[model samples]
Target: MDGFDNLSASEKAEATELQRMIAVEQQKAQFQAQVHSFTDVCWDKCVDTPGSKLDYRTETCLVSCVERFIDTTLSITNRFTQMVQKGTQ
Candidate 1:
């Protein structure tokens, strides 16, 4: 904090912008991590192999994979809530 206070106006501004950039990069990294996790799960469920390019069947499977994963997440969440409520009562 004291070091930041010693910074010139321009340096402070640059630091602020750099902080913002770092925050954005952190968010991007988190998003990428989520995408990688989803891709890993979905790829196993969908993609059999990679040859030259993605085939129509694989593409369709990928789409279904994401949809089903989301659906499964929601379903589990709902059921978990219901189970908790039932237990509480």
Candidate 2:
């Protein structure tokens, strides 16, 4: 690919915006994948069988399970970020 320096101002802005859009899309896709994985795992743990609708207890369990998954994900991510910062320093 050609050097970004050769791009005109408007072209540079357009490329930057496109890159931002791509990043947003990637984040969306990653979040969706994570949710799917979490749902599958929580389903196996909290669900006894497929029903027309979930019972209150099962519903609560699923919600808590998903929240726990989110909390763990955030905690791990924060730990990794901290480790990276420490390494850089």
In terms of lDDT, which candidate is strongest?
2
Q: After superposition, how far is residue 88 of candidate 2 from its true place, in Å?
A: 1.6
* 20-87 per-residue lDDT for model 1 (tens digits): 99999999998788678879998888778778899999999899888887788789989999999999
Residues 1-76 of candidate 2 have per-residue lDDT tens digits of 6467999999999998999999999999999999899989999999998899999999999999999999999999
RMSD of 2: 1.9
Worst 10 residues of 2 by lDDT: 1-10
C-alpha lDDT of all candidate models, in order: 0.88, 0.95
Which pairs clash in model 1? Answer: none
Clashing pairs in 2: none
Model 1, residue 20: distance off in Å is: 1.0
Clashes of each: 0, 0
TM-score of each: 0.55, 0.90
